[model samples]
Target: MPVSLHGQLVVAISARALFDFEAENQVFEAGDDRAYMALQQQRLDEPAPRGVAFSLVEKLLAFNEGGAPQVEVVVLSRNDPISGMRVFRSARHYGLPIERGVFTRGASPWRYLKPLSAQLFLSTNEADVRQALQAGVAAARVMPQAARASAAHPHELRIAFDGDAVLFSDEAEQVFQRDGLAAFQAHETSRAHQPLPAGPFKPVLEALQRLQHSTGGGMKVRTALVTARSAPAHERAIRTLMDWQIEVDEAMFLGGLPKGEFLREFEPDFFFDDQAGHIASAAAHVPAGHVAMGVAAGQG
Candidate 1:
C-alpha cells in the first residue's frame, strides 16, 4: 500500500543547518570564486551527493515512506536561485513528495511560511529553527549525516532532551547556573510536584504528544528525558511531564554523571541540550543539538 502523507509535514534543511559553511571557510579557505561557483553549479544532478545536507533530505524522505503518515520535504535555502530546483528534481526521482521549496534571506524564515496542519521541520540549525519554533512551527532537530545514516525500516524515532533548556524554560537553568546548585535545587524541590512552566520546545513536544495520542497509545515515536537533576529534585521534572500529559518512554536522572553513555544506550536519533560539552560528546554517537535560550526582553 502506498504511504499517505496527507497529514504529515516534513522539512529538509540545507546550508544553514547542516554544516557551518562560514566556519568551514575559516578552516579550508574555499575563497570567493570557488565558493560562488560551487553555489551556482547545477550539482544535484551529479552522481555523488553534494554534501551532508542532501543526504539528510534523502533520509527524511525514506523515513516518511516507512511510516503510516504521508510526509513531504521543504528544501530550505537562502536566496539560492537554482539550488531549490535541483533538489526538487532529485527528490522527485527518489519517489519522495517535494513540497514547496522555501528560501529565506536570513534567519527566522519559517515565520513567514504558513503552518501545515501536521508537520515536522528537520534542521541542524538549532538556534534559527528555534526562533521559527517560538513563532509556532513544528520543527525537529535533524543532523544531515544522521538522517542519511538512519535506517529506513520504520524503526521507532527516539528523541531525547534535557529538561530545563531544551524542554522547559531556562528559568530553572539560570537559577542553577547563576545562583548555584543548592539554591536551584531548593527552588525546584519547593515546586517539586508543581508543573514547570512552558518554554521554547513546549509546542513541539505537545505536537508530538498529540501524534502519540492519535496513534492510539502505541509508540510511533519514543521520547526520553536525560538530565543532571537527581533524586529529591526529580519531582519537578516528573510533575512537568505529567502536566503536559506527554508520555516519555524513559527518564534518566544522571545527577552529575556524563550523559554520553546513557545517550549511546538509548540510541536516540537526536538529542538536545544547552550545554556544549554534552552536545559535543553526544554528537559523536547520535546526532546532537544545542538549544539556545530565549533572548531577554531588552537584549535585541
Candidate 2:
C-alpha cells in the first residue's frame, strides 16, 4: 500500500523556517546557489540553531510520541539536496522526529502542499508563502528576526491568530478598510446574526481543535483569536465561530490596540496575523508569522 498522510495535522515548513539559516540565506540572497550549498555542506556536522517556528514544531511533534501519529511536520524548502542534509541532521540533533522534506534547489516548493495535505505552511520566503496562500493552504511568512518562543509553555502548544483575514473572511474587514471604523461597526452590528465567511486559516484552526481532542500525548493545544475588532463588531466574529462549531480558548477584542504587550502575556508558541503592523508588534514579544492574504494583503 502507498504511504498516506490523510487525517493528520500536517505542517509544511521551509529549511530556514525550521532552523536559523538567515546568515546562509544572506549568501543565497547574494545570488550564489553553489556558494550557499557549499556553506551548508561545510556546516553539516554543526547543527543549525532553532528558528522562530522551532518551538511550535517541537510541541506538535510531541503529539506523536506515545501512540498513533496525530501530527506530521514536513520540510518543504527551497534549499538544494546538499543543504537538506544539514536540515535533517539538525532535526536529529534536536530530537524533532521530522522525517520528510522536499529540497527544490532554488525552485518554488509551495506546490507540494497539496499532496502533503498540509494545513499549515511556514517559510521565510514571502513569495512562497503568498503562493501557498493563493493555493488555499493556511500559510505564513515567518519573521526570522522575531523573538524566540518562550519556554513558559513547554507542555502546551499555544497559537494566536488575527480575526479579519485570518480565522474569518475579510468581508467585514474590507468594509472597515474602505469606509471607516463607524461604518465597519454598523455593518457588523447589522449582520451580527449572520456568520462571516470562512478565512484561509479556518481549516488550520479546525484541525488544531481536532488534534486537541485526539492527541494521545500529554501536550495540549491552546488557541486565541486576538483581533482589532471590539464590541459590536466583535459580536459577529464570535457568532461566526459559533456558526462553524469551533471553540477557542481565549478571545481578545483589543479595538486596534498594540498587540505586543497583550501577546507577551499570552506567550504563544507562534502568532499568525495578516496585517504587517500587528505582526511587527507581536514579533517583539513572541514568535509571529505573517499571513500574506485577504484584505490585509490587499488581495481580497
Candidate 3:
C-alpha cells in the first residue's frame, strides 16, 4: 500500500526554523544564490544547531515510537537541493527521524502544504507563512532570532498561544483595536456566555488535544492560553474554550503587561500570538511565532 499522511499531525517546517541557519541565511540573504550554495556545500558535513522550534518538533516525534507514527515532520524549505544536503545532515546528526523534505530553491514553498496535509507550518519567511495561513492551514512566522526553547521540560511538549486572533476569532480583537480597552472589556463581558468563533490555530489546538489523549510512551502535551485580556474579559475566553470542550494546562490574562517574563517562567517550547509586539516580547525569553491574522495582524 502507498504511504499516507491522512491521519497524522503533519508539521511542515523550514530549514531556518528547524535548525540554526541564521548565520548561513545571512549569506543567502545577500542575494547571491551561488555563494549561498557554495557555503552550504562546503559545510555539508557540519550539523546545524537546533533552532527555536527544535524542542517542539523533537518532543512531537516522540509520539511515534514503537507504533504506527502519529506525527510527521517535513522540511519545506526555500533552499536549493544542494543546500538541503546540510539540512538533512543536521537532522540526522540530531537523531530526528525526519526523512521527507521539499527543496524549492528560491521559490515560495507554501504551495506544498496541501499535499502534506499539514496541521501546522512554521517558517522564518513571512511571505510563506502568510500564504499558508490564507490557504487554511495553521501557520506561523517563526522568529528566527528568538531564544531557543528551555531544556527544563525534556519529556513534555509545552506550547502556548495568544487568545485573540489566534485560538479565537478576531471579532473581539477588532473591537479592541477600534474602540480601545473599555469598549473591548464591555463587549467581552456582555458576550461572556457566547463562544468566540474559531480562529486559524483552533484546529491545531484540537488536533493537539486528540494527540495528547491517544499518544503514550512517557510523552505528554501541556498547552497554555496566554492573552492580554484581564479580569472581566477573561470570562469569555474561558467560556469559549469550555464551549469547545477543550482544556488548557494554563491560562494567563496579562491585560496590557509584557508577556516575556511570564512566558520565560512558563518555559514553553513554542509560543504563538497575532500581534508583533507580544511576539517581540516573548521571543526574547522563549521561542515565539506570529499568527499573522485578524485586525491586529494587519494586511499583507
Candidate 4:
C-alpha cells in the first residue's frame, strides 16, 4: 500500500518562517555558503527560536494530537541538509511533531509544493513565495521579526485575511486603485450578488475549514475577513462568501480606516494582507503574512 495525504490539510513552510534563522541567514545572504554551513553545523544541537508562523503551525498541529492525521506540516526550505539538522532539533526542542523536510541547499524549494499538495506555504523568502503563488498554491511572505501571536487563545487557532486580492479576486481592488472609491463602490453595488473569484489564499481557508471540522477534540480554528470595503460594497463581499457557502466567524468592513487597532482586538494567530500598508499596520499588532498578489504585488 502507498501512503496518501489526500484528505489532509497540508502546509509547507520554510525553515526561516518556522524558526528564527535571520542571523544565520545574513551569512548566507552575504554569499558565503561555507560560513553559513559551518555556523549551522556548529549550532546543530542548539534549538532555534520560534519565528512568525510558529504559533499558527503549533495550534494547527494540535489537531493531530492523537495521530488522527487530519493535518500535515512539511518543512520545505532552501537550507542545506546540514542546516536541516538544526531545524529538526529545534522542532523537537519545541515539542513540535514536524518530521518531514526538504533541504534544497540554496536552490528554490517551491517546486516541491506540488507533490506535497500543500494548501498553504509560508516563507520569509519573497521569491520562493512568489513561485509558490504562481504555481497555484496559497502562499504568504511571513514577517520574520513580527510580534508573536497573543497567547490568550491557547486552545484555538485564529486567522484573519484581507478581502479583495486575498479571499477574492483583485478585480475589485484594481477598480478601487485605478478608478477611485466612488467608482469601486458603484461597481460592487452592481455585482452585489455575484460571487468574486477565489484568490491565492482561498485554498488555505478551505483547508482550515476542513481541519476545523475533521475533529472535535483539539484546538479549534476560527477565521475572520478583515477588509477596507464597507456599506453597499460590503454587501457584495458577504454575498460572495454566502454564494460559496462559506461563513467566517467574523467580518470587519472597515471602509478606509486603519486595520491595526481592530486586529489588535481580535488577536489572531496570524493575519494575511496583500497591501504593504496593511501588513505594516497588522504586523505591529499581531503576526502577519504578506500575500504578494494583485495591485499590491510589487510593494511587498
Candidate 5:
C-alpha cells in the first residue's frame, strides 16, 4: 500500500554530503590512477561507511524504526552521478528508505516533488531552491545534517539557524565577512530598530508559521536562533523576528562563545550555519547543515 504522507516529513539531501564529491571529481577529471587509488584508500579508511552522510542515513533508518508519521529522504545530486548508487547501497546496508535523483536539465526538480508531504529539501544549490520556494513549493534549502535531523524528529521539528546568513540577508554576512566584527556590529546597531531584509529561509519560515497558526494548541514545530552577536545587536535580531511575527521558541545570543554546547542542550533536530566549522561541531550533537547560499555546480 502506498503510505499516506499527511503530516509526514520528507527531506532531500545532496550527493556532496554522501561522498567526497570534490575528490571524485578531481580523480575523474585528471583520470589519474594514483588519485583514484588514493581516493579508494581514503574511502576505505573512513570510520563511517560509504555513500550518503552516514550520520544522516543512520538517523533516517532509526526514524523508520520508531514508526509514527512516516519519514522519507530523497538524495539529490548532479555531479559525481554515481554517488546515488553508493547512497542506495549504504541505505540498503543500514536499512533506510532513501530515494535519489538528479536535477532536470533545465526544469526544477522540486516542482515535481510537491506531492511529498511536509517537504524539507536540502541542496548546495540554494538559488534554484530559493526560486522554487518563492514559487510556493514546500522546500527549504538546507545542509545534509539539518535535512536528516529534521526528518528524524517528526513529532516536533526543532530547527536552529544562525541569524545573519541562514535566516536574514547575506548583506549582513557580507559586511561581517568582508569588514570586521566591529563594523558589522555598527551596521546592525544602526539598523537595530529597522527591519532587516528577509532571506532565502524566510519563505520556509513563513510557511512553517502558517502551519503553526493553523494547527491546534501552540506550535508543533519549534525554531530557535543562536547568534554570535549579543546585547544591542541581539535587539536587532529580536526586532527583525518580531517584525516578521514569527515565533521562535528559543533565542540565544552566545556573544562569542561557540554554539556547539548551547545547541546540544537545545537538542534541535537540525541546525544550520554557513561555516563548515560550526556545522562540523554541531553535527556531532545534532544534525547540522552547511548552507550553500548560491548557484551550485551542475545546476541549470
Candidate 6:
C-alpha cells in the first residue's frame, strides 16, 4: 500500500505566510537569491516570529490530537532548501507538528499542491496564490501586516469569509463595478431566490464544512460570512448558502460600513476577502487573506 493524503484536510502554506520573515524578505528583495540563502543559513538556529496566520495554523493543527489525524499543514515555500531549516526549527519551537515541506528555491511552489492534495493554499505571493486558484485549489495571498488572531479562542478555529468573489461568484461584484450601488442592489434583489454562483473560495468553505462535521471532541471549527451587503441584497447571499446546503455559524451584512470593528468582535482565526480595501480594513482588526479573483482583484 502507498502513503496517501486522501481524506485528510491538507493545507499548504509559505514560510513567509507562517512566520515573521519580513526583515529577511527585505534583504531577499533588495539582493539576489545568494544573499537571501546566506542570510537564512546564518539564522538557521533562530526561531522566526509568528506571522499573521500563525494562530489559525496553530488552532487547525489542534484537530490532529486525541484521535486519528484529520489535518496536515505542509510548508510549500519558495525559499531554498537551506533556508527551509529555519522554517522547520521555527515550527518545532512553536510546537507545530509540521513534518513535510517543498522548498523550490526561488521558483513557484504552487505546482506541489496537487501532489499534496491540498485543500487550501496560503502564501504571501499573489502570483502563486493566483496560480493555485487556477489549478482549483483554494488559495489566498496572506496579508503579512494583518493583526494576529486574538487569544480568546483556544480550542475553537474561527474562520471568516467575504461574500462576492469569495464564497459567491463575482457576478454581483461585476454589476457593482459596471454600474453603481443602486444597480447592484436591484440586480441582487431581482435574483434573490436564485443561488449565486460559487466563487474561488467556495471549495474551501465546503472543505471546512466537512472538517467541522468530521472532527470529534478535540477542536471545533466555526465559520462566518462577513460581507458588505445589507438588507435586500443580503437575502441573495443567504439564499445562495442555503441553496448550497452550507451553513455558516454567523452572517454579517454590513452594507457599506467598515468591516474592521465587526471583525474585531468576531475574532476570527483568519478572514478572506476578494477586495483589497476590505482586506486592508479587516487586516487592521483580524488576520486577513486577499483572494485575488474577479474584477476587484484585476484592479490595481
TM-score of candidate 5 versus the correct structure, residues matched by position = 0.58
- The lDDT values for all models are 0.59, 0.92, 0.92, 0.90, 0.59, 0.91
Error of 3 at 180 (Å): 1.6
Q: Model 2, 4-57: lDDT tens per residue?
A: 988889999998988999999999999999999999999999999999999999
RMSD of each: 5.6, 1.5, 1.5, 1.2, 7.7, 1.4
| Superposed Cα deviation of residue 273, candidate 6 (Å) | 0.4
Q: lDDT, candidate 5, residue 293?
A: 52
* TM-scores of all predicted structures: 0.74, 0.98, 0.97, 0.97, 0.58, 0.96
Residue 262 CA error for candidate 2 (Å)?
0.3
Q: Write the per-residue lDDT of candidate 3 for residues 165-270, one digit (tens) a residue.
A: 8999999999988999999999999999999999999988998897788655478899999999999999999999999999999999998899999999999999
Q: Per-residue alpha-carbon lDDT of model 5 for 1-300, expressed as tens digits?
A: 885656544566555555435555567458564564456445643332433254444443344453353345666554333334554655565556665455342245556456554256665456656655555443334443332333444455566777765677667767766787898889889988997887656755665565445433222667888887787778888999899988788899987687877888877766766565666667666666565552221211
Lowest lDDT 10-residue stretch of candidate 3: 210-219
| CA lDDT for candidate 6 | 0.91
Backbone clash tally (model 4)? 0
Worst 10 residues of 5 by lDDT: 291-300
Residue 264, model 6: Cα distance from true site in angstroms:
0.8
- Model 5 CA deviation exceeding 4 Å by range: 1-120, 124-154, 216-219, 294-300
How much is 164 displaced in model 6, in angstroms? Answer: 0.5
Q: Write the per-residue lDDT of candidate 4 for residues 1-300, one digit (tens) a residue.
A: 989889888999999999999999999999999999999999998899889999998998889887568888999999999999999999999999899999999899999999998889999999998888889998999998888999999999999999988999899999988999999999999999888999888877887887677663467889999999999899999998888778899999998799989999999999999888889888998999998889855553
What lDDT tens digits, residue by residue, belong to model 1 across residues 74-150? 66655344545555655566555666666663344555435433344555566556665665554545444432224
